[model samples]
Target: MKKQNSLFARKPAKSPKSKASMDYPETLEIIGLSHEARGIAKHNGKTIFVTGALTGETVRYEISKKHRRFDEAECVEVITPSPNRVEPFCQYYGQCGGCDLQHLEHSEQIKAKESLVLDQLQRLGKFNPESTTPPLSGSDQEYRRSCRIGINQLMRDGTPIIGFRRRGSSKLLQVDNCPILINPINKILGKLKAVLSEADSCKEITHAELSMGDQQGAMTLRIKKPLPESLSSSLQKLAEDNEFRLYFDNGQQINAFGDEADLSYQLEKSETQIGFKPGDFIQVNASVNTQMINRAMDWLDLKDNDRVLDLFSGVGNFSLPLATKAGSVIGVEGVEDMVQRAQNNAKQAGLNNCEFYRADLSKDLKALPWYKQGFSKILIDPPRTGALEVIKQLEQHQCDQILYVSCNPSALARDGAELIRQGYKASKFCVMDMFPHTSHVESLVLFEK
Candidate 1:
């Protein structure tokens, strides 16, 4: 039998003095990066995860929190920096929790995400793809079409603090502009902040959801109470001046200020328009989303007689596009409003072959009427929790092809393993840079029988 190394041997419990000394700064070489983009190091047989550090660099980190299996730390100083490190452009790069890989070069960031996805598949799924295509990426800045801005009414001397949350804290970090947001939204941030500062009902405001479509922009403010007429007029004027639609939600119904403007994005390849409400989920990266959909269509090799089943379809984002090529397309979503919205979108697109249904995908779906159909191709864009339950149920359909778009790699790996067990082989795999500068991983995998 192989003897265990003393370096990894279990050590006796440390005294109170030794435990206190652990708070001191320690220097170590960063050997790897965690899924969250933190540096990985080992000290005295215990693993250490250091934030703000990169691989192949020597860093001095201070322990922030200690755990039984490992220690958490924050890099205070870099003794040696890697060549891939770049100066972050955003002024609030380190202070804001919106981005994680701003300091790393953009190309290196893509490679890291791809590596992370592959690592998850191998380590968690216990499988490897036959081939990995080049990663799908777009502009790393000013690409976010939507954002949720936090509001702290109690902060900054009664003036509403508007921005994202601070790094590792619930406290709000006031930001004048975020580079990742689209140019129009960034341009109006200061103006909006000024308007809120002067408004009497600003304290009643909680947060704001901003979304930009191909032709128009929309903002929805979540409020605790009804806004006064004066504040409402000011907001309406602001939206008019900015050429964006404004709406107010008081935890019940959403009311528009002036005319109800249609908020929708265009899928250029398919020539399809998808309309969505303010709080509805849509891909923030427009370029990547277009590319992702186009690639999915190409990978599926849609035929005129193909019957496609789109799971977790949102506002017919994919179902409408698929209907343009396939003979028939069925969309299943968990939200009733989204199902209705999708049906309306399909009707507006003049695609009668596409249908939308509301179903709880996590529960047993065998009893659903749509389950009886023999689908030739299946596409699932599940949430971060993934589609393990749906994948398990798919075995009864004998689908010829399955395309999965995932935002969470761990969940994808768990579901991918199930698909593999059901006699599906992963043929094509690629990472999508959906959220640039962040540790979030979005990927696409095509499985074939």
Candidate 2:
């Protein structure tokens, strides 16, 4: 048996003796990385989250609280630098907490994410995708427009705060301006915060989901509870006051339309026009999504007669595009609205061979009417959970080729194991830095039977 390394052994936490000790953090070297922002430094082999430390960074953190095995606090001083460190671009970068990795360079972020995929493929899946396909990639900034931001109704001191969660915590980060976001949505965020600060009916409010369409934005309000009719009037007034369309969702939805705007996207030197809603799950980095899709298509190596099945396909994102080249395409989605929107998008695109079906893809795929279609090509773009059931079904079906786009690698690895076990092989994959300055990594893998 391999001996446990002393670096991973937990160090005995010292008592909080002096107040000065709390303010002046003990400088420590960061060795290994914790799953999150916390890094690991060990006296023995026992592990703890080196508060305020990034992987390879050496820093000191004021230990606010300590236990037998771990210590926690905000990062205080940088004793030494990590090779991966970069100056943050956003002025309010660290304070905003919208992105955790603003301190790393773009290329480093991609490499880190790719490394994660390689780790998962080797360790969890017990296979390698070191050479299968070219990596998927996208832009780093302004890629996120659809997000559910939280708002603190009133601070303990009666002040108000609204925005994303704090770094390494569930507490909300208070800020009026978020520089990492797209300008238009950031404007809405500022205005909305200002408006909520004064609204009489809105004593406390949760965050809102803002999505950008090709030309307009779709906004949804996720209130804490059922609001009064007068409150609805207030929301409308707020919208008119700011010149932006806003929708309210008090456990239910009240849809509203915005003035039509045209949006154009580039794909393989071709610019495709799109009309979208602010609340729809448009890829955060639109330009990067185009590149990612292009790479996926290249990896697919499609044929004119190939029949493609797109799982977790949102609004014909991949399905419709495949239809442009393939014989027929089927898109499966859990949301009826998204499914219908995909159909509309296909019609608008003048693609007749694509079809969209509404089904709970997270559940069993066998229940879906289209499960047994036996498609020649398959693509999955699931949420953070990745595609477990869908992967299982694919293994059972044994499609000729599959392209899986994922945001979470752990889940991807879990499913990848099934694919390898069932005769499918992960040939190649790359991590795209869709989000920079944060821990999130987007991945793409091509598996073949």
Taking all chains together, the TM-score of candidate 1 against the true structure is 0.94
Write one digit per residue (lDDT tens) for candidate 1, span 1-449. 22111111122233233434764435779998889989899878888887888888887656667789998777767778878888788988878888988878999999988998999999999999999999999999999988988887764477778899988878899999999999878866767888887875487888888888877788888989888999888888887777688899889878888876578988875657899887788999999999999899989999999999999998988899899999999999999989999999999899999989999999998888888978999999999999998899999998999999999999999999999999999999999999999999899999999
Compared with the true structure, what per-residue lDDT tens digits does model 2 show for residues 1-449? Answer: 22112211222245456536444335566775543545666544545565446677666554556667765544556667777666776666655556666666777666666766787778877788848444555556766755677867663545567788864468887767766567667777777766665555454356678666554555567776655666566655665554456676655664553332233233445534444544456677776778787887788888889989988887676776678778889998887877877888788788888888988876777766677777898898999877887677676677898888888888888888888888888887877767766777788888887
At residue 104, give the lDDT of candidate 2.
Answer: 62
Worst-scoring 10-residue span by lDDT in model 1 = 1-10
lDDT (0 to 1) per candidate = 0.86, 0.68
| Superposition error at 201 for model 1 (Å) | 4.6
TM-score of each model, in listed order: 0.94, 0.84
lDDT score at residue 336, model 1, on the 0-100 scale: 92
Error of 2 at 227 (Å): 6.5
| Clashing residue pair totals per candidate (backbone < 3 A) | 0, 24
Residue 268 CA displacement from its true place in model 1, Å = 2.0
Candidate 1's error at 34, in angstroms? 0.8
